[model samples]
Target chain A: MTMLPPPTSKKLGLVIDLDICVGCHACAVACKEWNDGGQFGPLPDANPYGAEPLGVWFNRVHTYEIEPKEKGAPAMTVHFPRSCLHCETPDCVTVCPTGASYKRAEDGIVLVDEDKCIGCKLCSWACPYGAREYSEQRGTMQKCTLCVDRIYNESFEEIDRQPACVMACPTRARHFGDLGDADSAVSKLVAERGGYDLMPEMGYKPVNKYLPPRPRRDGCAAEPTPAQEEKVDFSTSPLLRWIDKVLSR
Target chain B: MRPAFSVIFFTVMSGCGYGLLFLFGLALAFNPAVSGRIEGLVQLGVGAIFVVAGLLASTLHLGQPQRAWRAFSQWRSSWLSREGVASVASFMPMVLIAGCLWRGADATTLRALGALLAAFAAITVICTAGIYTSLKAIPAWHNRFVLPGYLLMALLGGAAWSWLIGEWTGGARAQPALIVALAIASCVLKHFYWRHIDAATPASTIETATGLGRFGRVRSVEAPHTEENYLTHEMGFQLARKHGKRLRNIALLLLGPCTIVLALLAITFQAPLHWPAACCAFAAAILVTAGLFVERWLFFAQAKHVVMLYYGGARMHDA
Candidate 1:
């Protein structure tokens, strides 16, 4: 039962644009808020007001400073949001001793069936992306469901269905759709922006992709002339010269 | 990577148990005269105690210990599940062999059951090693050294313990030279493993992790959170170089020279089935087990998981 299913062509995933992310953590906050009470409710936080607070979150954002490759080019900061990539050949699912962790063949979403999980934590170790979250209170392994409940819920408005992180991104940095479709908006965006997979050499064949930061124009090799230091010609306008003389007196 | 006490205890205890079980089975099948009925029963009882204790200790590591039985369902794909199944399956032959010893069964039946038990015991140990070797996320464990290391160490510990038991019961002694050879081989394998990890570079780096290598050098300026999260808590354990070196030295001394010398001393006094040989074997057994404990601890503590790349551990080996 832990064996992986054949590859799915309907791979639904996210395409995150690093060029526009402001690192405000709104997406992460929205994910916690929704998943905390939505289907995967009560993401427990230990010591809420104490010195050390620990909890399970489906998404997290990291910021990194990149030194420009060219000497004169300015350094840039990239806000990186990380979550489950929903890998095609995730070892996390196959490594499960219990048939708890699995990847759906329909949408290529990796999920943990909490009811069957024995909390062995082997799946957590198998994940190179650190996506699996262990809940101390529930005694089960939890992870990013990609908002499976909301995405397929017919009760919600058609426009309201999507991952909480993607929906809440103010800069619209996150895009979600069926990446398997070549003509889909998300796929086109990926192709146009050169979207690439993170740690491709890991060979997980991640469904999610990231668009790199665009080049900036601030580092162009050009000097500006100082216009502020130019002297005014009083002889050109006699009226302007008379007004200036009166003001000086 | 965190080196949980429960897991370390489980592996070490179980390794000794299975090792002893294999040797016992081998002796019973090849030469029944080496052990009397009472001595055979005693050996089986000891091995069973250690095996049961180890299995119980492993359950403590699970968050839901009551659901451990579910783990046996996925043996088709998971090495951990296979290990669970193999270990439980092995107990059947163990019980049958015990019945044969107690009931004075025919030599042919006893030999068949003993051979089955030995095969089962060895397979269980292999499954145990497979659990770590299958994990490609940790480079230190996903290597050729880990498999042989586990096998050799288990045999050495078992041989030493069997020597002690044989001396105490006035039965046939296990070869002292075998113990010495096993000890030296384990030492050499451990050295190779340590050297391999020390010189190895991580396959995944922060640049690859973020897919930003074209931008130039990437450094984490801000962490996702101020408080430590589950990933960091479980995988970010860092052993200080000074302490790691000291512990490695201690493990090497106890397992290598100390064990070899004690084994040699046991050989010198083998003619007299008295306190001298027994004491040497007993001391060797105790030191070997203690040394293995330290070695196992280092094994987990030193492993660097690839997920550390996201948390400012730019390179896996550097972490």
Candidate 2:
């Protein structure tokens, strides 16, 4: 029963743009807020009021500083948000001893059937992305369900049908669409921006993609050009000169 | 990689139990030393206690202990499930063999069942080792040495306990040289395993992790969260180099040369000083078990998980 299902053609996933992300914890916080009220609600927080508070979160944001290759080049800061990739060959699902952890065949969204989970914690270990979170209170494993409830809800508006994290992104750095469709908007963005997979050598074949930061521009190149200075010259314009004389009177 | 006490105890105690049971089963099948009732009682009693105690200890880490029976359902894909099924099946033949000894039955049934128990125990140990080796996430555990190292330690522990039983029951003369040889072999294999892991490189680097390999260098400017999360807590355990070296030395001394010396003394004075021989054998068995525990602890503490790259761990290749 733990054997993986055949590969599906439709892979629903997110595309994260590193260039525009502002290192804000909005995505992480939005994820927690929405999921806490939806399926797998109320992510347990043990010792929340104590000196050391601990809780489970499905998404996390990390920041990194990449030093420039040239001596005078400026350093770049990259904010990385990590979550479940819903891999094509998820080791977490295969390593599971119970049928609780499984991938959906219809949409390729990996989910946990909490009713059947034994809380063995093997799935968490098998995941390279640290996607699965163990809830001691529920005695089951939880992870990003790609907002299956909201995305598939018929009552919601078309624009409100995306994941909470994607909708809440101020810069629109997070995008949700059918990554399996090469002609989809998300896929086109990936192609244009040179989007890449994280740790591709791991061979999980992650459905999610990340767009690398664009090349940094030089400091002086942003200054005004000589061509712009030729415009709005009062000395060369007769209308501007007449307006200046009338204002002086 | 937290080296939870429950898991450490489960692996060590169960390994020793399986090891001891294996030797007793082999002896019963090939030789006729444990034909007497008292010898059979002592052998079965020790083996059952260690094995059962270990089995119980393994459940301590489980969040839902009552649901453990469900683990046996997926033996085809899970080594843990296979271990559960194999270990439970082994007890069937073991208990039946014990019953035969209790009733003074024929040796033929006992011998055949004993052999079956031996095979099952070996398989269970292998399955347990496979649980760690099969993990591609942890580079240190996913190696050629893990399987052989586990088996060697099991054999060594079993041989030591068997020698003690032989001395106490006066049923048979255990070959001390064989115990010493197994101890030596385990120590040598452990040394090579340490060297191999030390020299090995991590499969992925920080650049590869971020898909920024085209860029020159990448470093973390800030952490995702201020507080520790499940991933960090479970996999962030770090063992200091000094402590690791000291523990390795202690384990080597206790398991290798010290055990060899005690075993040699027992062999030299078995006839003239039976009391001293029994005492020495008992002490050596205790030392070997303790040493193996330390070794297993290092095995977990020293492992580096790939998830650490997201945290502030230096490049995986740097190790």
Candidate 3:
């Protein structure tokens, strides 16, 4: 008898704040570090320094400029960073010809068993997210496991076990927690800030929620204050005096 | 939707094999009181060879062929699983009935079992077709026309096979008429499937995919990556537009009327048992099967998966 895997409560997911992300690609590098160290092994590279360098990576941060308004963007550019949304109804698992791909019944994290994978590349095709990357050297599939090996390690401190991207982010844009639990930090954050998922119409019901960029403050003045004179000596350069005279004229 | 060669071969060979048996089923059913026991045995015996050969070829594609039985386990949500289950289940009864029929067992029990095999034969044909029809993601495949198209194909393709066997042992009396009708129907079906798929809106437009408004201006200025990725290799097979149209027409010409004429020629010469008709029909179907493979390839290649929008293929069309 076959049964659909139970939907789990310990839903590991990410909350990405579009407001603070600067597209530094730290998360992508952090992800590669952890995935390489754990179950997925090293993502091999072909022609590392040659004409066309290629390799498998579980995460690749995409940068896209947004106007966000009809007028050309007056403010700094809004960079969009994309990764696997870890959708609740991931089509990749169901489309697998082998049982190597599965959704976790414990944490709602989708994963592929590298040992059982035949490298047929069907899961990659099935995933509309383009989440799964094939490791050509290993001939197996690799994806963000939600840092399963780190999140559950008994040796690490409770807070230290979160995904490397979440821990390493300097701007604090990425939040990690269980979305299924109402009292969880992510759920509260989502409820308060009006967080939204990307491409919700796709109906994947993505676990990760993106907090839309907050609207800029109105009536904010832009000026250079007189306090600037405290640090610089105007008498130092004749060129500076000439610029000041030209400004006054 | 990956154009795996093994799968293409599996579908074609099985389709032809199943078609031949389906015609044999109709012939046995058409004559309730016929007394050609030795001849019936030979026809059934020969047809089974093609069926088994096609099925055996399919196993070569499996990664872990030893675990092939596990495919039957997940029939609930999976159409591929159901196909494997139905195919294996259908094989058992067919073998039993054919084995008995070949031994000249025309008893009431054997005849009843043979009828059961015929019903199961239809199930096998439909189940095989269901593998593609069930995929809701591929708009070209998941449609109303697929069900009847497959059923019609089985009956029509089966007619040619039945005609061959009928000429060999049963006589060419009713086989030619069945082939004529089947040929026309098959031609019409292929046309409808092609037409419907060509005109349908892509499942999602680039705007809808990118979360832009339906009428939003979206275009791909630059691709995200320099080299092709796994997603592109597995899904991004593109066929030239003009060539596909020409090839589809070529398939109809080669497989459709060309086959019917050969069967008709065999009829005119009173050489139903002659090699020309069977040879021509067999060769034409193989060519058409190749053509259908290309058609199936285009079905996947032409489909714009929603994710392609993110990598700057955000071109929008009228939904």
lDDT of 2: 0.85
Q: lDDT tens string, model 2, A66-126?
A: 8767665667789999999989888888777767778899888899888778887888888
Whole-model lDDT per candidate: 0.88, 0.85, 0.64
Restricted to chain B, the TM-score per model reads 0.97, 0.96, 0.82
In order of DockQ, best first, we have 1, 2, 3
Name the runs in model 1 displaced over 4 angstroms: A218-249, B240-242
TM-score of chain A of each: 0.89, 0.89, 0.83
lDDT per residue, candidate 3, A1-249, as tens digits?
Answer: 223366777778998887788767788788878777776677777776777767776766654444334343333334455667777876667756557778878788888777666664556655666777777677777788888888888899998989888887889999999999989999999898877766665566788887766766653233535665444466988999789779768
For candidate 1, report its TM-score: 0.94
Q: What is the lDDT of residue B30 in candidate 3?
A: 54
lDDT string for model 1 (B65-159, tens) is 99999999999899999999999999998999888888788888888888888898899889999999998888889889999998988888778
lDDT string for model 2 (B278-316, tens) is 999999989999999999999888777788898863865
lDDT of 1 by residue, A1-249 (tens): 688889999999999999999999999999999989988777998887899999899899999998878876777899999999999998898989989899998999999888888888999898888888788878888889999988998999999899999999999999999999999999999999999998888788999999999877762534665568547789989999999789879
- Measured against the true two-chain complex, the DockQ scores of the candidates, in the order shown, are 0.76, 0.68, 0.25
Per-residue alpha-carbon lDDT of candidate 3 for residues B9-81, written as tens digits (9 for 90 to 100): 6665566566765555545555533426556555555556656665666666554556556566556655556
